[model samples]
Target: MNSDDPLSLTSKTSLGAYYESHHVIGKRLGQSFEEGQRGPLLKRWIGTGRRVLDLGGRDGQLTRHFVDGNHVTIGDIDAGAMRLAREALGVDTVEVNLNEALPFADASFDVIVMGEVLEHLPYPHLTLEQVRRVLAPGGQYLGSLPLAYHWKDRWDVFRGKKLWMARDPTHLQFMRYSDLRKLLSTYFEVVEIVPLKGGKKAVRWPDQFARVVAFHARKAAG
Candidate 1:
């Protein structure tokens, strides 16, 4: 892959178009539900006056929210997605391949948001380490990942159905709640972790019940 090629190491399919197409209608609908649930929770932490990096922010839907009083930058492997982010949200963009070191200086951002992105990386630990490095001291990292699912992933493991994420060619990792928290704790001080789309009762409920969980953690002093 040509290093300069925006499409290098990424699916040839237009990332922006994929988000807008019927194939992702379910995901779009889910975002609508999450808006009323997780969106507000994130706004309080990610809002005004911070330098934010929206990693894997396809098309800027989540990116636009943080742009109110913040400097938001989009980073993704797909050139088409970053273009959409620039054109639609008027934010800056950096083409990033998550498997490699991020192309930014240390402590470069105050907040790093990586919604629906952790699962897609081949080396999530290395990527998080980079995220920790770029994040300013006292900076927060907010992102979401799938919690183990009974019907989808767990069932596949038990009944031997094909892996759930394999359907999406880009997905390269799968995680459970404990695995995620343990990993985050290795680099950050986890402040909050909650289901992004549920009622108050969902707060204390087991993580396996929810399809996704959102996290907000501050960069460790290390």
Candidate 2:
């Protein structure tokens, strides 16, 4: 919205369209979701769960880890990707946009997994609110996203470059640990924050040393 007037109606590529292009690229390159500690962490944290919602879970890449013990339902924006996910994983899929209200009742899910999806949202707060609303009391929210405040990112600023890690045109939010923690605190009680893929320094200072961070949070009991 920065490029346009404060009130003028403007147009941009739909989220589904943009992700559809990346989905095609990812498939062609034989790229699965980040094949590292992220999957194992999600599996262990969300163990033996049913009534799970994999938000924006395209093609069931990460969903495979925890889908065995749970009745997993995927909610995503792209139809083509949902088709692929169904074929690959046989999970129920819902076609919904995170930019708008989710089409689920209150307290609909026991666990919600949002892997690598938050940074792409234009209205992340609204989606967080929706997730909070759809979760049952004491339900858990597990999420992962790239953190943009590592030492390498700081180095880019010194070299007069954009503070972006990859060539993703859709990454609208580049958050540090504190930024995202503050946002998550508004809706849930944050229980854990695990930083991934950095040196030993990351264990002490995840906000500055880690490249990606995963968060575990729980809704307050009613």
TM-score of structure candidate 1: 0.79
Question: Which 10-residue window of candidate 1 scores lowest in summed lDDT?
Answer: 22-31
**CA deviation > 4 Å runs, candidate 2:** 1-13, 26-30
**Per-residue alpha-carbon lDDT of candidate 1 for residues 73-141, written as tens digits (9 for 90 to 100):** 988765655677788879999888778899999999999998888887778889999999999998999
TM-score of each: 0.79, 0.89
Q: Which residue pairs in candidate 2 collide?
A: none
> Residue 128's C-alpha lDDT in candidate 1?
93
TM-score of 2: 0.89
Error of 1 at 66 (Å): 1.4
